[model samples]
Structure formats: C-alpha cells, structure tokens
Target chain A: MSITGIEIRHLRYFVAVVEQRTFRAAALRLHVSQPPLTRQIQQLEDALGVKLLERSARGAEPTAAGKVFYQEARNLLTLAEQAAERTRLAGDGRLGRLDIGVFGSAVLGPIPRIVQRFRQTHPQVELVLHSLDRIGQIKALRERRLTVGFNRFFTEEPDLSWEVIQTERMVVVLPEAHPLAKRAVLSLAEISSEPLILYPRTPRPGFIDQMMRLFHQRHLTAHVSQEVDDLVTAMGLVASGFGLSLLTDSGRKLHVPGTIQVPLRKADAATVDLCVIWRRGDDSPLLAEFLQEARALRHPPPEDAEPVEKPAPRSAKRKRAPKRR
Target chain B: MSITGIEIRHLRYFVAVVEQRTFRAAALRLHVSQPPLTRQIQQLEDALGVKLLERSARGAEPTAAGKVFYQEARNLLTLAEQAAERTRLAGDGRLGRLDIGVFGSAVLGPIPRIVQRFRQTHPQVELVLHSLDRIGQIKALRERRLTVGFNRFFTEEPDLSWEVIQTERMVVVLPEAHPLAKRAVLSLAEISSEPLILYPRTPRPGFIDQMMRLFHQRHLTAHVSQEVDDLVTAMGLVASGFGLSLLTDSGRKLHVPGTIQVPLRKADAATVDLCVIWRRGDDSPLLAEFLQEARALRHPPPEDAEPVEKPAPRSAKRKRAPKRR
Candidate 1:
C-alpha cells in the first residue's frame, strides 16, 4: 500500500472516529455503518504502513502520528473548499488583477474618473496602470500583459476589438499674447499657416498623423515649427511662444500659466475619439464590468462615431452640431 | 449554480483542457473521450456562471478568468497530493514533532546520544525537550503535552506505560580531600552516619523518597544535612565540603572543581534505573522509534532490572556481580 491508496473519504472517516472516540459514534455521525468505518480506518493505516489509532473497550483515540495527520487533513479540506470559492469569484471577475494600458491626455480626465468608479465597485481586484501609446497598447494586449487599453486613433485590427468611450472636438492651444487667443473659437484654416508645434515624433500613425490628416483634408499645409516627444513638451513650446498647438478637449485640463485654449470651428474641426481596445474574444468578466463603466460615461456623439481613418466625414457632419458641456 | 456544485474532477478536467488548449487534446492526455471532456468543461463554466473559454476552429483558449481559475485549480490539486504524502510520512514517524519531557541528570549522558541519533535518522522530525521532574513528566504525559518522558523512579500508573532504558549504579559525591574519596568504592553502611545532602526538596515520592527508601532497606538512618532543589545544588554542597551527596552514574558527567565521585559498593548500592514513560497504548511511530533508540543503549542488568520500588532485591542480587564499564 502507498500514499495514493489513501482517499479523501478515508481521512474523513478516520478523523471522525478519533473525534467521536468510538467507531459506533463515528458511524452514526457519518451516517455509515460501524463495520465499514472500522475497515476504512484499517485500510488507511495499511496504506500508511503505520497504526494511527489505539482501540480499547471504551472507545478509540488517535496516536501521536494520528494527531499530525488529523491537522493536515483538516487543512487540506479547508483549502479545497477555498479553491472552489476562489475559482467562482475569479469567474465572476471580482477577485483578480486588471492590468490597464493608458496613454497621454486621456489620463488627465476620463480615465481617472472611470478608475475611481471601478475601484469603488470591485475593491478586491488589483488595478495596474501602464502608460503606453497606441502601438505599445496593441502589442501589450497581444502579449497578454494588458487586459484592456485606452487611447485615441486606434486602427482596425483582426485580433483586437475597439469601442468608442468618448468623443471630443479638437481645440487649439495658443500663447496668451497671440491674436487667436482673444477669439471664442478659431477655424483651423485661419491658423494653418502659423508655426504649429506637433507632438509625439515617434510611433508613427499616431495623434500627429491624425493632426496632419486634418490639415491635408482642408487643402492647407501646417507650418511646422518643432516636433517633440509628448503633449507636455508641445504645450511647453506653445507656452514659451514657440508655436501654437492643437489638442482634444481632455487636454484643456492642463492649465499652463502663459497658454490659453480656444475652441475650433465645429465645421472645420475634426472630432477626436477616445476608445478602449482589448483582445477580440476576451470574455473576462473584469473587462465586461470595466466596459460597462466606460459606456456609462460615454459622450453622446454629434454623429455616428467612426474610426480615425474616416475623420473627414465626421467634420462635415459636425457643421450643424450644437455645443456640448 | 453555487460553488458547491463544482467537484474536484471538474477542476481537474478544466485545467487539463486549458493546458492542452483543446478538448480533443486534453481527452487524449486524460484518457477520456472528447465528448465527456467538453461536457465537463461546460458544466464547470455553468457552475461558475462564467465563460471560461473561447472556442474557435483553431482551438479552445482560456479567457482571462479561465487563466485565474487554472492557477487556483492547479495549486489546489498539488495541495491535495501534498496532504496525502504528508499524512503518510506522519504515519511513518518521519515528519512530525517528538516532545520529550527530560529532567535532572538524564540530559547529561544517554539522552543526548539517543536524541542525536534520532536527528540523524529523521531530520524532518522536530525534537522539543521540556525540563520537567518526575511528577511533571507524568502530568504532561497524561495531558498529552509530552510524547515521551525520561526520568528516574517512576511509579507505574494505569494510564502510563514505562520501560527501563538503562540501569545505573549509585555513586557517592564528596570533596576531593575527604578520606572516603580516596577509596574506589564505599558501602551505604559506612556513610550512614555522615551528613548527606539530599536533592529535589519538593515533589515528594521522588528521587529523595527513593534515596530514603534505599537507606531504610538497609535498616540505617540517614544523617540528612541541607536539602537542595536540583542535582547542581547537591553537587555544589558536596564540593563545598558541607555534606556528601549520592547520585546515579549519569550524574558523574558533571565535574564540580573540588568534588570527586566514588562508586557505591554494589552489594549495598541501590541501582537507579532511567526509564521512559508515555501514555499507555500511544503507538505513535515517533514514540516507537524513540523507544527503540533508548533500548539500543540499555545497560545489561547485573540480574534483572526492576522498578525503583523493588531496588533492594536488585542490590542483593548485585552482591556477586562484576563491575560494568
């Protein structure tokens, strides 16, 4: 006989006998016959190659080795029960880590609010945020490092799914002394010839590409002043009177001392969208709950929301749209 | 469905499917049919109320929740296997604690050797030694606080069993300058009128009682001097030339600077036996192994080893006995 020969039932029976202090009492507690209980304890001892209990005329008592086995068995049973309960909680998406990939100005506004709501609802889940751009987000998602990603201008992918969480019309950042800063709203065509500081020089097909596409669609060439790494660098250049910069409504939250933001003419301004992306068929409940929270805060679109590839038509449709809060 | 609806087999099946990445592959590995394997995974997902896998023409892949559950299930299965293996080891006496009650001079000699040998053989077993006297040993054994105890002059009780491990001849401790210390051996009658320091003032029916009984058996009155607490105090009194003290051979290991030990004449000396006591019918493998080690160091008796109550007859039998090493 080997360790494998001992079964979970054998442990239950032996523990019952030792606890109840009599085979007859154990059988009654287990709702089994006394002979069967005795035989099972015998089999357990045989499998272990050591006697676990000493039986007398009065009752039964565990030997020293039996006491040790009893504690181990009880712990194992408790762990087994806990495993099932934890697995169920995991399936419900309430007891695991959610790694989120975030980027740029999105972290300034909507993302923090959504994260706070998620924390309030699912307190047990750990939330990890990785600051990654659009291309990095997609790569991390495919590598299973990110459960979900939030960013702008995500191109369609066969293995990834994207959903528009919010839409913001473009805004232009100008130095406080610039002539355009006095206007309530400025048309992009009016400042197309002005020195413009575009951001995020690397990771092509990003926000810079979308900005260039907006200028090209209107038959205007942006006078490029300097190309920098991120939104903060571009805003800094604008603050120092180097050039004017363009941003989404979310970027307005960054209040530079010497810079002011002016809304763009809705007819000429392209609407930029913030969308969430994940693996195409990820059915994780955590992802579902997060998406639900995002949808709850979704901005009502002026027109049907479309991917960044078709930004020209969205601008044309926004000509008659009313201003939003 | 509730967590209780899930079984260990369901977890096993689900983990196999997730690891193999397909029902057919998992079935091949588990030696089961694909239909039943698919059904089991479905049942597991249903019980959890979560979609654990995404099935496509390529293969079945685990969802995010499925990944979490897979880890938990694997850990639970491993713990179950460990539980069985640990219980078997405990039963085999190779993986538990052996709490020993030790007192007085027994810690000096044979006890340490037996403990060292036990450690070499069973490295995983923990040995806890509690300094307890004869009465304390009996009480701790009854309370299940001690797996085994070692001391001298243990009275047989209904609930405790004892075996003589070693039979030690008595020795007289005196100041090195005393005339009796020059002799190789001295009889009890010669020292009957000498001031004798007795030890263990409390816990009567102990070593002091055994000493008084030995003198009584010889019809000699002991001229008791100072009564101290332990072996060290008695030896200290002997070294200071206050009074002579008697101890078993085991106590000879302690060498007080001005004191020397001389053997008691075998014909008049009462043989003190070091015996191990335990709860009757303990049958713990650890206890059994410890007893085996103790018995291996047993000193062959001059005649038959007897309990402390019958030490007089053993002394009579040892009159013609030769000296032991």
Candidate 2:
C-alpha cells in the first residue's frame, strides 16, 4: 500500500469520530453533512484496512485496531503541527542557525563582542563561526555559505553592504634591543627606513596588501627584511631581533618576549576598520539583532548607564613594555 | 501564525521547486503552471517570513534559509508517510498487539504449546496473555479488552464463537494411603461414597461446575470433605489425606508426595472440553495464527513423523503409595 495514502484529513476524521463517539455526532461537530463524513470515515477505514468503529443502535465504539489507530493519528497530527511551528520560526530567523564568516584576527576583536551579545539576547539561535580569509568570506557570503561576515578588507561588491563596526590604530612591534625601542611613539617614515617584517606573504590582496598600501600612499618603499606566514611567526622573528612589524592593539596583547610594542605617530592615517557585511537585499531577521548588538558595542552608553565591559580574549597576555635592553 | 496554514501541499510545492532548481521546471514537473507555483512559493515564504529562493538570470537557487526549510520539510514528509504505513499495518492486523485472555489452569494445557508455536510464526506480533476468570474473560472479550480467550465454559452467547480443541477423560486423585488407591480403575459410584474435595471454590461457573454436573448426571451425590481455592492447595489437602478429587491428566502431572492418580473406569462418560473462544465475526489476524497452532497441537503429527512431546507442569511430586492409614 502507498504510505502517503493516509493524510492529515484522515487523521482529523478518525480523531473526530473517536472523540464524538458516533459518526452522526462527528459529522455535526466537523460541520459536514452525515453522508460525506460517513464516506470519509469509510475511506479512512479502507486506507488503514481496519474496522475502526463498530456501528450500533446506541452509538459507535472503537475496536482494538481502531484504538491503536486513533492514538497514532493523534501523535502524527501533533508532530506535524510542531514541525510547522518550528519551521515558521526558523524562516522568521527567530529560531534555527546563523553561520558567521570570521577572519583569524577578527576573533580577537568585535567578533567576540557581537557573538557574546547576540547569544545573550537570542539564546535559541544556533551560532556557527566559520574562520575564513577575506576573499573566502566574500565568496561564501555570495554563495550563501554565511549569513554575515566580520572582516577588515573592503571591496566594491555592489550586491553586498559593508558597515564598519570598529577602527583601531596601528602600532610598531620591535625587538627590545632595537634602536627605536625607547620611543613611546614612532613616525611611519622612521620605522619604514628600518628593516620591516610583514606577515602572511601568501594569499595576496589580504592584510599584507593593506600594509603595503600604507607605504605606497606615502610614496615611500618599505625596507623588506623578512616575509613570514602568520602573526605568531612574525612575532617570533621580531623577538629574535629580525625586524619590526606593524599591527593593532589586539596584536600587542600577544606579548612576545624581548619585544616592545610602540604606538605609531600616524595612527589616524594608518588604521584598519573591522566591518560587518551581508548581502545587500538580504533582510534576515537575525542579522538585525546582530547589527544592533554590534552598534551598541561600537558606541557604549554614558557612565550613568549600565557598564559595557570591554571584551577581552581569554588568551590575552599583555605587557605594556618589557625591561629595556 | 496559524500552523495549519502550511499544509502538505505547500511542502510538496517547496520540495518540487528545490529539486527542480527552477520555478518553471518545478511547475512543469508538478503538473501546475508557473504563475501559480510562484504564488504558492511566495505564500509559503510569507507564512515563514523568509526568502527561500534567490532569483537570478540562470535559475532559482535556495538561500541559506531556503536550504534549512527544504531539509525540514523533507524530513517531516518522510516521518508522516512512515506513520501512515505503520498505522495501516496495525489496522490490517499484520502488526500491533494481541491480548489473549487465559484462565489459571489453561497455562498447563494447550495454552503454552499454542503460544510458543504462534510466536515462532508471527514474530512481529506482540503477544500479551492476561490471566482472568471465566466470567472475566467473557466480559473482557465483549468489551474489546481481549482479542480472544482460551476457556472451556460455553454459554448461549450468540455473539461469541467457541471452538473445542481438546477433550480428555477425567481421572481420580487420591491420598497414597487410601484403600481405593490400590485400584487400577474406579467407577464414580466407588469414589462417590468417599469424601470428595473440590478446588477453586471461588469464581462461579468454573471447573467446579463441570465436576458437579458430572456427578449430577450420574444421579450420585459427592461427599465433599474440603473446599480449596487453587490446584496447589487442593493437592496439599489430598496429600494430608483429606479426600479424593477428580482431575485431568494435565492435573495429574501436579503429583503430590502423598497422593496417587488413577484412571476412572467411567472416564469416557466423565470428560471435559478445552475450547478457544472469540466474538463472532471478530477477525484479528493474529488469532488465525493461534488457532492454526492450536489445531496442529490437538491432532499432533504421528509419533515417527515428529514426536510431539507431552507438555507437563514442572512442579509435580508423585508417590505411588504410602503406609495405609
């Protein structure tokens, strides 16, 4: 027999008959004429191949088979209603999943703030953060792999809307024994003259490009000393007296031994903006809550209002300045 | 939102679109035109408040929200179909429960054999045996609490059909030390003069009535010495030299240490029938299997063909004779 032969209509009819205890009453309760109701019940019995009710002069009663069928039909209807309700919630973005495209360093900054605040407010929403490169995040967002993304690099994707959430000034990380280590704040030109190390040389047009653009805008070439693959490797190189590197305050918290992180004088010019990006026309309900939390974090209320605790990475090991060499 | 608004038809339409990957092809496959298909999907989206498909020059593709909805809808449909299939099986008596009403002593006779054989063939059937009295069995059968019953008592109930399976000769049970215990066979008149003991005095119209009817037919009065509730208690009474009793061979198997069972000479005239009863026109599929096994047991295969070992209750302790009292 075909499984789909029994549908919601059949279940409703069976439950009605059992509850009403008679076909005549069931028909009246269901607002249908007796002939059609009887025909429907007959069809349901035929579909199930079991005599659900034994008709008598007084009323009808469920047979052993009918009792079992009634219970299952009730269960099936309940599950169907629950499925519909949950699916509706999922579609409305009140329930279901949110895939956030994240960059490696983004996890240390606004990503944590946005995720923490979103989880607190919308605890029912499933949050999945996919660590990807800026290009990967952009492709995934377009391919519908991500609901939203947190990244620094911005490109002209007319189909997407990017809103900058936080901007941080750049800093110079130098080996303690370096000549410029004593400076509280150093100019970009003075640091550019020294042998400078940059990270993640591969995956072109990424953070490396952002660093290179800063030098190119000034019409000065950087003294390339070493090209390392990641922030940890760059920090290791600086600690071993290789060269100086440029990064943000979040990077300074790494605290590499024998290294001193000094703020750059041209902070306003050499800065990076962490932005939240999504498809231009995509008005996902959950994204609105995320954007709201992110905006609140970017601009906290006054001191008289509830305190906004600064989001810190649990792995932070910040040292203002190591013993001067 | 009203959950009932999202019916199975809506899920079918959504799945069709997702599978065909284009509204035009989906509508064609679904035997519906494109406009209606588009409208149906829009309505579904409106109900869910989420954009399931992203329209493009190539075709329609599922958004992140659409993908999740498609998966959930597919699952719900599959579950509903399975529920229907199982319910149908239950209605057809191919699956589901079978409650067999049994009497206490019935377990010692063809009941165990019938149950074991039925279970072997109908492994998928759930068998539950409820031990009740003769009246309890009849009442339960009428109320649909029992699918079938194993009983010997027959009443003039036009609504029930009773099929006698086995009839066995009655025998005499006596204290080992009694003078009549020496006889290989005894007549009703020989034991009628002795103090007779009856069992299961409670639950009217039971085995006691059968024994009483035998003596009444013989036009002889039994000299009852003691009345007991169960077979074990009766056996204990006989072992204490209280009186003699009438029982079948199956009952003889419950041999007490100080008692001896002897075949009565008028066994042919003093017999009882064991029958299986069910409501007339009550066709439960599992009952057919039970009847088949029971019939096979009644007329077992020849000794050389396959030895049908006689079923005996394990709790038996027999003594041929004891010191004459």
Candidate 3:
C-alpha cells in the first residue's frame, strides 16, 4: 500500500515482462539478467501482496493484476517523457507565459506593436498586461509579478536593466482660442511668462525633471501654475485656459476637445525618452522576445542591408529639435 | 527540437530550479553543485532550443518556456510514481482480470459458487467467463486464452495441473413408466440387461470410457440403444422410453419432465470427479483465491480450527467410487 516503496525501475521491469511474455525474454529486452528481473518481480509482488505473473514450463504470463499494472506503467513512462520534452520547450522560450507591466501612455506607442509581433511568433505564450506607473512597474518587476515594463523615463538601478527605445520631441497643448494657439511655434522665452500646467505630479523627479532641466539651461524660471496626477486632467485644465502643458506626440492618440497640440520653437524644444525596464538578468523567453520586437520596431533594419554583428547602441544625448515653421 | 537527448534528470533539475527560483538553491536541494544544475539546464535548453531560465544575482526564474517545462516535468514525475504504485498492486494480485473457462453442466454445481466467493474477496478483479467443453477449455488454456477451466474428465498433460474439487455420484435417469422408476435403487446387473442411451458420442474415450470402465469392472455391459450429441437430446430419447442413461447428480438441476432419477445399488453405483485445470505455476492471485474458495467449499474446515501454515495439496488420485444405494 506504500507507494514510496514502488520505484520507476519496477514499472519498467513489469512492462517489459508483459510485452515479452516471459521472464527470460523480458530480461533480454530490458538488458538485465533474468534472475534479477525475476527477483524484482517477486519484490513487486511482495510489496503489493499479490501475484502478478504466472510462470509455467511453457512460458510466463501476466496474472489479471499484472496486465492492469503493465498498462499503467506504460502510461507513467510516457508522461515522464512528455514532461522532459515540454520542459525543454519552456527553457527554449518557445512555450510559456509572460506578465508585462505597462504604463498608460505606453499603450499609445511601441508597446502594442511590439506585443503584436511577439504574439505572432509565440502564440503559445500567455501574455498578461498590468497597468502601472513607472514606480509601480519597478516594484512589480522586483516582486516578479511583471516580467518587463514600458515607461517614459529611465532611472539608474543596479538591480534593474534599462533600454531606451525612442526619444520623443515635446509639444505644447493650448486652448484653440488662445493668442499663441495660432502661432506655428513658440519659444521657451514666450512660454516662460505663461502660467504652465504639469501632470503626474507624483512618482517624482520624472517628467517634471525634464521640463525643469530645459528651463534651467536658459536661466529662465518656469512660471508655476497647477500640477495634476493624470494627463487627462492636465489636458482638461489646458482646454479651460489654465495655461499650456507639454506632452509627447504619441499622446495625440487621445483627443481632448478644444485643445490644440503645437510644436515648440526649435531653441525651446526638449525631448523625453520612452524606455523599457526589467529586473537585471531576468531571463524569461517572453521578455527576451518582447525586447527583440520593441528594439526592431523602434529601429527597423534597412532593406537589403548587410548584416552587422552588433548594432551600435543609440545615443542617450538629445538631438536638436526641429522647428515647426 | 530534438528531445531525445533530454533525460529525466534534466526534468528534475529544471523543476527544482523553478521551485527554488535559483540554480544555487535548486542545486542545494538536489544535492548537486550549482554549476552542474546550471549546465544541465543549459543542455535542456539546447535540446529544446529554448531559453528556460533567467539567472541573475538575485536568483533564477523560469522564462515563459521554463514555466511550461516545470509543470510538465512535475506531471511526468507524478505519473511515474503512480505507475510504480499501480504495478505494485498488480503484482500483489489485488488489481487485475481473470478469464475463466466453463462447461455448461459445471455451472450447475460448485463453479458458480466458487466464482461468487472469489469475487466477494477480490472485487477489483475483472472476471470473464467463456463456455467451453473440456477439449476446448484445454486448448484455450494452452493458448493462454483461459486462466483456468472447470471440467469433468481429467487428461494427463505435463504443462497443465489439475485438481479434483468433488466427485459426483452417478444416478440413473429413467422414464416415468419404466419399471425401474418405481424402485428405490437399481443394480448395474439389472440395468445392463436393459436398453440404454449415451450422449455426446464424439470425442471418443470421454465420459463413455469412464462409464465403460465401471461396467467392465462389474463384468457387465451397457445396451446403448441410441447415441446423441447432447444431454438434452439424450434426455428426450429416454423420456420417450428409448433407454435409461447415467448422469451426475448436478444434471438433475435440469428439470427433464417425465423422467425420474434413481440412485443405484451400493455395489453398482459409479461416480465421476469434477475437476479444475490450469497451466501449472501460473501465479495469478485471482486463481489462488478461487482455488482457496473452491477447496474450502468442497472440504469445510472444522469450527475452532487454528489456521494451518500450508493447507495440504489436494490429492491428484481419484478416490474410490463410494456405494450410494
């Protein structure tokens, strides 16, 4: 009755005996000596308190019990083999699941395209998307709930790896009736005098830091206005003439009525990067596949281009912002 | 994609890694060095052509592929254990099937009772019943189609062993109007002078041989007026006053109208043994149980008897046919 006493070897031996229909034949098939095979069978019988085989001068045959055992043994062996195969596939990253952390704005950009491409290749993988802020994503990654995260800024963390995808030029959202709304471009000097609205005030030193750095470079102080926790609130305030707010072009996917997106003057323009972050050395195949797709979509290979062993990493330095007019 | 190289050890290692969430911890659990566990994982990955684990300073985690592998490996291991357990039970003869050979007339006596007792003790066993004559039963036993057979005549065979359960006393089946029908008992000397009928004329040297031997010993001869293929047909002829015939008491279970069974005189009575035959050394627990029940029924033990370490083997020799006047 104690299954602990039963071993894999017993199943193999029993199955061999049933298939060969004789102890001698089963022993030969299993590449073992007949006496040991016979002894093992006896041990099995003793353990189960039943007689599984009948040995006559003519040959050996399974008792009714033996036949049942033989079938179960075969099933177990097959399952074991299947487990090995499935494990290998999992290791290869061809099969499994991925839990990904996504910030709101990320869905409007490379994240969706990257996810789509990854799915096309790895349909078997289960992809779970959780909406979280940059800080929340980082915490979830450390806790192993989220395999990877896509956000608008990157911070240095030794325990985490960061890969920047694209740097988007900043634009201004203004009420359509505002005097500057008709202007094709507006310099930092002009906007510096205007009351400004900013969003996602918490998870600090993030988007605000980028804006502050831009004004600090020109020795101009940004006019303090109102700070909100979400882009929609910021846009709402702007449409009500609560001053203008800066957002990336990808945010254009969401249209707030009565608000107009305007390109900044070249000298005043600044850009923020969208990046991916994950726990450093996390080796889930799903994450790897997502990284590959994100990188490929952000920086596609040129047609008919010769292969390069390693592509040069993108520069972190911001490029000169192009003028709108 | 070639899983042939992936061994059970790899599955164990991979599962341990995922459970421990680190190769170092998995190695500790498996009692192997971390490097080998890591290498085996890599080998597993190579065989499956997938990445299964992400190893970092914090620990290791299954990639999506690794996750799938982990579940399958666990299943395989569980099945292997179950197989062993089932095999042990089969060896114990607690779980299996038995195909029994039966003759039409044998079912009227101890065979059905023996089968019922065996079933009550071994409910897990599957019992298959096949109706066969003595010759067919013997051939089926040799071909392994039957586990054991209940038959009337015992034939000598080195590959088969036989045990007599009961010897049925012979009785005369006579027509209601026959002179012997009114007698309490009749002698072979009296019956020898009257017309008689024998059944199943084929398979020479059968029950007729046994009947003839009894008559020859008495210095008498049977006047067989007709030969029929079956007992029913023989009974029909006897009902019409064609002749009288000898039958075992169990045949009385068949209610043949217009016939009467008359016990023979003590000096003239004959008996035939009903025996069980099986391939010698067949070690099915079902057969063992059946034999025990049958023997117990045939020879009920005295009340308050202590259990014997080994019940004496049944004597193979036929007993003297006791007088039954």
TM per candidate comes to 0.73, 0.70, 0.64
Q: Sort the candidates on TM-score, descending order.
A: 1, 2, 3
lDDT of each: 0.79, 0.75, 0.75
lDDT of 3 by residue, A75-178 (tens): 87777566655555454454577888888667667688888878888786778899998889989999999888888887788888887777777888899888
| Candidate 2 lDDT over residue span B221-256, tens digit each | 778787788888887888898888878767766777
Q: Which residue segments of model 1 deviate by more than 4 Å?
A: A1-63, A95-103, A123-147, A172-246, A255-261, A264-270, A299-325, B1-43, B51-61, B94-99, B119-136, B143-147, B154-156, B172-245, B255-270, B299-325
TM-score of chain A of each: 0.74, 0.68, 0.69
Q: What ranges in model 3 sit over 4 Å off?
A: A1-80, A89-97, A120-124, A154-161, A170-247, A252-270, A280-297, A300-325, B1-78, B88-97, B120-125, B156-161, B171-247, B251-269, B279-297, B300-325
Q: Give lDDT tens digits, candidate 3, residues B1-325.
A: 2345666577778888899888888899989998888778877766666556776799987755566777787877676556556555454444577889988666677788888877887777788999998889889999999988888878788888887777788889999999889999888888998887887786676787788788889888887788788788888888989989888877788768999989887666588888888888765555666667766876654455332222233221213235637
The DockQ of predicted model 1 stands at 0.23
Per-candidate alpha-carbon RMSD to the true structure: 10.7, 13.7, 11.3
**1 versus 2: better DockQ goes to:** 1
Tell the DockQ for candidate 2: 0.13
